[model samples]
Target: MIEELAHDPQSGAPLSSVKNYPGPEVGEGLADVQTQAYRTGVRTPEQHPLVEWSGTREGTLTNGELVSAQRGLLGYFRRTHRNVRDDPDPSMDSTAALALKRLKAEAPRALDSFVWYALAERLAAKGYWAAWMLDHVIARCPHPTQRVDGEVVGRCGSRLKFRPGVGKLEGVCAKCPHEHGAVDEALVEYIGDIYRASFDEEMEARLL
Candidate 1:
């Protein structure tokens, strides 16, 4: 799977896609996590590369800050990916297998693996996991239509919905409002924030 994603079709040269380039949202969340770490007396680096990379300055980050961030990121990643427990899709299983294999092959050290997992957390937070799986793991695109609680919905036009009758175990969807479009975007962002923050904590631990 990694080999397939590494090649450029036209040039046939090895290709790489950047992951977890810090952005405004990540910067803000990191700052929050840093603050929490400071309050808890967690040690951090004098200058966190991620903070600098994000172009947000809230003083130097400490190891404590990274630890806090890692906790949050891992929690978020687990929750978002946990949907597979309810959905039980083979595609997700394949994606997980490929991701693990790539992680093991590429990351020689525990710290290196943490970095890769952190990047993956960011990608998943950005709601790009599905597209990534399609590009790297699955050769074909996802079906345009999805079945939610026995109702068929256009993948692009559907909004995940939770109601009384439709058990939480069974995901439900409905036509998205024109104004709302898709609520999952907000959910994804929320989940992403948690994932990124937790990743920092995990990285800090491995560094220690």
Candidate 2:
């Protein structure tokens, strides 16, 4: 599977797609597993580039803070990638795999895999045991998110952002009347779509 993805004609091979870097060395030391995991998120660094902000910092009101927060999460993924590459480990791969698998099993009806993958990658970066334990905590939390922050505000109220069902998970966001922010419903939904896509990309890049 890795080899086939490595040489996709449209993408010009995974190595070239990601700048012909040949990815991390995977072997008895679990180099291959780690390589596969990172590639699972971004087919090419050019398309994803590790991090991007959906909203600007110059906004007023708490606009799309969730979107910005989500972008920060994306950066976290890139950071994790670099960290894992520098200090490659097989257990990390195993831990990420477990995170995804467990999420899949628990979130059987999840509309997307991006969030699940992100959860796994985030946990694995810390350590497999840590990730595994975090996985259990996430599973227990119905919403799985603690809070949402605005990423953009523009002229349209505060563009608040948070994980879907974030307000439901804890009494945090729900305590306030403006949990979803003051942005247009359409715009909020659109941002949700983007996160959904990001989640997919993240999972694809790290899945082992």
TM-score leader: 2
- Estimate the TM-score of every prediction: 0.20, 0.25
> For candidate 1, which ten residues in a row score worst on lDDT?
134-143
lDDT of 1 by residue, 88-182 (tens): 44454444444434443433222211333334554554444543322222111112345678843322323245444434332234553444433
lDDT, candidate 2, 1-208, per-residue tens: 1232121211111223333233444223545645555444323322233344232321211111111222333343343455446665556544554444444344333322234334555464555433432222111111222334753212222212344453552212222325333223443353344345434546777885
Angstrom error at residue 52, model 2: 25
* Candidate 2 lDDT (Cα, 0 to 1): 0.34
Off by over 4 Å in 1: 1-38, 41-78, 83-90, 108-129, 132-208
Winning candidate number (lDDT): 2
Overall local distance difference test of candidate 1: 0.34
Minimum summed lDDT over a 10-residue window in model 2 is located at 58-67
